[model samples]
Target: MSLRWKISATVAAVSVVVAVALSLIVHLAYARKQADDAHRLQAERIQLLLREYHRGSQPAFGSRLDDPAVPADLRAAVRGGKVATALRQTSEGTFIWAAAGTGDHVLSLRSDYRDSLGDLAALDRVLLLGSAAVVAGGTLAGIAIGARLSDRLRRAATAARHVSAGDPTVRVGAAIGGRSHDEATELAHAVDAMAGALQARLEAERRVTADIAHELRTPLTGLTTAAELLPPGRMTDIVQERTKALRALVEDVLEVARLDTATERPALSDVALGEFTTHRAAALAPDARVVVRVGTVVATDPRRLERILANLLTNATRHGRPPITVVVDGPRVTVRDRGPGFPGHLLRDGPARFRKGGDRTTPGHGLGLTIAAGQAAVLGARLTFANPREGGALATLDLAPAAGGEPSP
Candidate 1:
């Protein structure tokens, strides 16, 4: 259940319990008071009868008493010149009897209180219904309040998710009910501040990286030219190799900067995924295996797709064992390599720019998978890396479906 429903239910349950308890207490007290008043009135009537008999006025006994069913103990007490009262419950219902002595006879009176009992029963039903109404009103009020609060929380949660998914512009404004100083508003402001800080820091880093790469490109070109002019020797070969490595690193850094700023837009078009993957694999690495299970076309940027595939194939060849396999099923592509699999940290957190995997002594600068992930994001696809239980590294890219069109045959 949602938090709104849970809160509403709790409030409603408590209201019902309190209403019922209060109603029961009031009804019990009223019933007791009614019984006490009936007894007192009965005793008063009996006293008046005894007084009348003593004065020899002799009022009719049946006028003040009904049935006059007196218990033995009560009759003896009245005959002994003491006033007595008794409550009896017989097959005919409840009665209150009071008696007192006047000369040799006991002046006794009895009252059938079944009508008063009926009134109490009617009052009980009223109280029960009133309590139910009270409970229902409270429940509705609780639901309204809970729904409003949960809506505010849901908006805040959505903003947090957008921030997590690399959109820094999303902000969870003020609280839904417009309270300025509440906890929900405070939380929203905190999240906005955090997102702003992260965006600023990341942009600053990207600027620095892009500037450094741009500065190195000129020197790197000159260095390569100078190495080519050198005499053929071991030193020239070493210089050429180092220059090539530096050039590759600079290019990767520039690409990462571009991805960070999202300066590239996908030129989406329907492309046959199976044929495309086969051609790219043949050109990039003819030795690798390619398999098409469900050959369906997808709408995507062809250049970006090739970049993604190239990175995955290169990583497989460089870091993993042979028998690299590429499989396409609908808008999903899976690349599996028989290797030691990904490191634990990479599997958990995905790829980070310049974060190298495998042995530290490896030649590549570790931006291949990062570039692939960035390109996939640009094409509206999800790229996931995992070490399958079958003991190999698996990279799956799930692309968006073709735009309002069936897959090409």
Candidate 2:
């Protein structure tokens, strides 16, 4: 059940329990007080009868008492020169009786308490109705309070979801009703603040990366030209290779920064999945095997798709064992490599730009997967990494379905 309903039910249940308990107590107290008043009236009537009998004015026993209704124990008490009272329930009704002795004969007086019994019954009905009304009102109030709290919680949850989905502009506090200084309001403000802080930090990081990449391009070009002029030696070859790798890294960083800032947009095109995978696999890694089970067409950016595939293949070759497999199934493309799979953290949080995975010994600046992921996002695709049951890292890119009546070939 939802939190709102649970809270409402719990509050309603407690209110009912408390109301029932209090009603029972009040009913019992009122019934006892009424019984006491009835008994006192009965005693007074008995005393009046004894006074009349002792004053030489004998009253009629038939008028004062019902012989059949009076018990034998009450008559014995009156004959023993002691006042006595008893409450009795008969087929006729409920009654309270009192008796006392006057001389040799027993002086007795009895009051039929069935009327007082009826009054107690009426009082019980009133108490029951009032208790039910109290419980109903309390339950409704609880439901209202719970609904209000649930609404605030839902607003906060929605704002959190928006932030997770890359829209940091959503503010839970502003979206909710009048601002109260309650814990829920404070939590909403916290969520908004967190989103703002994250947006600012990511923007700052993107700016720094873009700035560094832009600054390195000119010097890198000069260094490349200078290296070409050097002698064809081992050292020259090493410098050129390192320079090329550095240039590639800088370009990847710039691309990722653009993707982050929404400055990059995909140029969509229809491409045959099977043919595209085969050609890209051949051009990128001819040694790797390409398996196309479902030959279908997809509408996506060919450049971004190629980039994503190329990165996955490169990572497999660099870190994984041989016989890398690339499979294209409809809008899904999976690249599996026979390696120790991905590190636990990388698989969980995805590839972060410049954050190396596995051991630090791996020769990569970790921009390949990051660039691939960012490119996939731009193409409105989902890229997920996992390890298959057969072992090895698996990278799957799910693209949008084919458009323009593109049939499977």
Candidate 3:
């Protein structure tokens, strides 16, 4: 159930319980008071009748001498020279009788308590209507209060989602005025503050990385030119190779910074996965096996798709054992390597820049999978890495949202 209904239901339940308890107490007290008054009035009438009998005057209508309507126990008590009273339930209703002995005659008076009982029943009806009103009012009030609270929380959660999606400028904007002290308002303020902090930190890091790569580019170009000018020798070849590796590292860093800014847009095109993977595998890793279980065509950026695929293939070849396999199965491509698989942390948290997976002695910098994931995001595809239960590492890229195909197997 939603928060609104839960709160409303809780309030309604409590109101019902409280109303029942109060109604029972009031009803019982009123019934007791009515009963006591009826007995007292009947006793007073019996006293007046005794006085009338002693004065040798006729008794009142409700009072009688030797009345057979009175209970035998009450008459016996009166005949014993004592005043007594008894209550009886009859076909008409409940009756109260009081008797006293006087001059060898018993004077008795009886009164029915039916009218007072009718009053109590009316009072019970009134209480039922009033309690119902109270419960209905409480439930409506609870619904209103719950709606307000749930709305505030919903807006805060939306802003948090925007922040998670990399729009650090998004703010909940609920912290305002006297209500700022409330829990919902406080949560909004916290989300805004967290987004702001993340924006500042990420901006600073990207700026530094971009600046360093730009500065290294000029020196790297000059170093490459100088090594090429040297005489053809083993030492010269070694210098050229190392300088080339350094230049590639600088370019990767620059690409990462660009992706972080999210300014790169995909150039979409229609491409067939079977033909594309076959060509890419041959060019990138000739020894890697390629299998197409289905023929699928997708609308996506071919260059970005190639970049993502290149990274996965390269990572597998460099860090995993031979017999790497790329399988295309209807809108999905999976690359697997028969090696020790990805590191535990890498699979758990995805890829991170400069945080190399597997053996630390691997030659390439750790930005390959990170770049691949960024490119996949740009193309609106999902790229996930895992170590399948049957040995090696697996990377699956799903482009189902933009794909059309018929599975062959």
Candidate 4:
């Protein structure tokens, strides 16, 4: 059940218990008071009868001489020179019987209490209705309070989700709606504070990375030129290959930092989706298969799209078994490789730079997907990764949002 419903149920249960308890107390007290008053009246009537009998005069009402209608227990007790009373439920109705001993004769007086019993029944009905009203009122109040609290919590939860999705700018703030010092308000403030702190730390890390990449670029250029000048031999070939790899790594670091800082702007242009994807995949991996199901035109940043595709293609070639397949349909491009798909952590957390799996056989750092996702964001596109049930890693790049509309296929 939802938090709102749970809270409402709890309040309703408590209200019902309290109302029942109060009704029971009121009913018992009223019944006891009425019984006590009836007993007192019976005692006074018995005394009046005894006085009349002693003065040699007959009492007018409720006076019985040797009444056989009295209960055997009451008759036996009263004959011992004592005044006693008993209640009996007979076919006539409920009645109170009181008797006293009078010179080998029993004097008795009984009052019909059925009317008072009816009054008690009416009071019980009133108390039951009142209890129902109290429960209903309490349930309604609980619903209102639960709705207010649950709404605030829902908004806070949404803001937390946005932060987890890498947008630290989203804040719950005072829009959550509650007293300034209330727990909900304080929770909103805490979420905003956490987002702010995260953004600060991310900015600091991005600045340091960008600075380091920029500093390495100049020396890498000189190193590339020096390696090219060496004699054509095995040793020179190794040096040039190593130099190229190092340069690529430095460039990737710089690219990721730029993506993180949101410094690169997408240069939108008209591109033929099928032709572009086919050509890029063939150039990157000549042995890979390129399939075009339909032809369409789309407007997007070609440079960024190429970078995203290149990273996906490179990751597939390095970590997966080929032949890779690149499929283009409308504004969507999908790259698939027959391999041990992606890891569970990658699927769960999306992509993070520098977070490579434990497989040392793979020949690149884990920035490929991160860079692809970042470039997709810059181009206003959606990129997703998954391990297909058919047993392969699949990367899909959807450019529909950025393309505005797919041109006629």
Candidate 5:
């Protein structure tokens, strides 16, 4: 049943019970009062009989009792004119019933008469009708209350669901009643407060990330092209080094952009990590030392995989004194640097794009670790940064194998 009806039914039921109990009490009391009146009226007869007997006129009055052997004490007492309170006998002169009372209250019971039971049934019928009326009235009142409450609750629930699904514009329609006591109204206010905070955070982050990307990309592109055009023989190592830094900056910006926008989720596939590493090593780190420890397979997109490795290799070249070893085991790939270890906190946030490099002492934009970390996340992998006991930072990407696939290795 609807909430309104259910609440009304409960209220009605309780009212009915209480009403019936009260009615029964009233009826019982009324019946007892009636019996008392009957007893008082019968007491008149006893007084009259005592007066006559005391005058020596009705001496054999005790012989008519149902218990023909009336109690000797009572008979003697009645025989005397000094009877204080005498027992009553039925007017037929047979002791069918008796009672003793001085006023309106019946204090004693009679053996043969249930003087009140007959009237009790009539009172009971009246009590039943009164109870029904009370229940019906209570039910109507309860329904009104339940409906008001349910309406407010339903409005709050609807607003909550809307906000949960990311529609910040949805609002609770009207006040349930007064602001002083409306719980749903208060809840709606709370939701509005919370939504405003979330929206602000999201907008601020979006604006900042976009502005930073715009500021960095133009100069980076120019620097990369100019470096490439310079005669390597004349510029020597300078051109290569400058171009590498510029390229790293550009890549980092792109990684941030891609991850920030939800448009590029990876197309997962089972690719053998060992095989993928072999291709990457051949293309980028051909002359550099490299090793694969296991033949594990991981699920990921190839293009995103290359981006992940490229950042790792670039970071190693820039800061890690590598001799890099790339290995695969189970569902993971380890990119180890045999260089001076990561500066304490790099492992914590995995690398934020602009926060690294630029100190004359450190060579590249801190973007390398950041880019790798972001891409790894997008492709369903966790990049763990750990300091090996031996030395350097060991970065691992734990990946999941594709569904319904073989070990590609």
Candidate 6:
């Protein structure tokens, strides 16, 4: 219920109670007055007749009515039965008024109490009917207000859901009241603030991606040309290796840019972990120790998964001894190389971008694990960097499981 309805209902209830009380009191008082007046008029007439009888100087009877101190009119009235001897009874109860002289003679008159009660009853009916009408009207009005309030609240809720479901354009309507204007305005202003923040964040990320692509393309082109000019010897080998590294460098940079912009399309599907590990390990190194836990499949974007695996294998070859081991469980593809594990400090927060300080001391762009972890995250995987107790550093690329099953180990 709205505030207005609550207040109005309270007012109506109190009004009904008060009206009933007032009507009862007024009717009772009026009846009492009428009874008093009727009795007085009857007494006055009786007294006057008795007084006239006394003034005639008739012979005295040895009766109690002859006493001079008694009002003659009252005495005569009592003898002639002009005064009512028995009070008329009423629903309000009967009352008897007697002449003071003797108990036998009573100047009795019915009180107007019944009439007064009848009047009161009539008034009660009127008040009751009126109160009912008032209550009914008030209740209906309260319900109407409640319904309107509920409607407005629903509209606001619907608008909120619409906004949440990728339509930032939904808005609340104006509240039509002088006192409520500020609150409605504040709600609208808050939604505007949220929408503005999302727009700003998206714009900034796009600008960053475009800038990175522009800055690195030229150096990458020169590296490619230089690599092509070398003859096929040790020099050519060096040139070709450098050229391949440069290309990987450019691709890693592009991948990072795409990730930042959320432009990488994730193709989610169930891939058999054992088979995938076998294929990847055979392609990279035939002699590598590849371990496959049976019957584990996961949903992932394959291209991103391949990128992450390649980065880890390459990193392992550079820093670790030969016979790198590849393990596949349901939602995981781990590459562990039998190399001196990463330094403890690096394990916690892996190698920095382009920082060339490791046991291998390889002279090349150092964007391997950084790109691996980033791409794993994009594919909804957990990439853990840890040095194994047995002696090598382990990189576990954990992927999300297929629906309706626990995640694969």
* Candidate 3 residue pairs in clash (backbone atoms < 3 Å): none
Q: Backbone clashes per model, in order?
A: 0, 0, 0, 0, 2, 5
By lDDT, is 1 or 6 better?
1
What TM-score does candidate 2 reach?
0.89
lDDT by residue (tens digit), candidate 5, 17-125: 8997899789878966766665565556555544454476433344122234444454444432322232344554423233222222222223334445556777788
Residue-level lDDT of model 2, residues 233-319, one tens digit each, is 999999999999888888888888898886577888888888999999999998999888877778889988989999999999988
Error of 2 at 205 (Å): 2.4
In model 5, the runs with Cα more than 4 Å from the true position are 1-202, 208-244, 287-293, 357-360
Any runs in candidate 3 off by more than 4 Å, and if so which? Answer: 57-60, 63-94, 97-108, 174-182, 232-234, 400-409
The lDDT of model 2 is 0.83
Q: Evaluate model 1: give its lDDT.
A: 0.85
The most accurate candidate by TM-score is 4
Which 10-residue window in model 5 sums to the lowest lDDT?
A: 100-109
Task: Quote the positional error of residue 46 for candidate 3 in Å.
Answer: 3.1
Off by over 4 Å in 6: 1-212, 215-237, 404-409
Given candidate 1, what's the lDDT at residue 74?
A: 80
Residues 79-117 of candidate 6: C-alpha lDDT, one tens digit per residue: 544453223554547543323222344332222335545
Q: Tell me model 6's lDDT, rounded to 2 decimals.
A: 0.64
302-338 in candidate 1: lDDT tens per residue?
9999999999999888888888999888788999899
CA lDDT of each candidate?
0.85, 0.83, 0.86, 0.86, 0.66, 0.64
- Model 2 stretches with alpha carbons more than 4 Å out: 55-84, 88-93, 104-106, 179-181, 404-409
TM-score of 1: 0.89
Regarding lDDT, does 1 or 2 come out ahead? 1
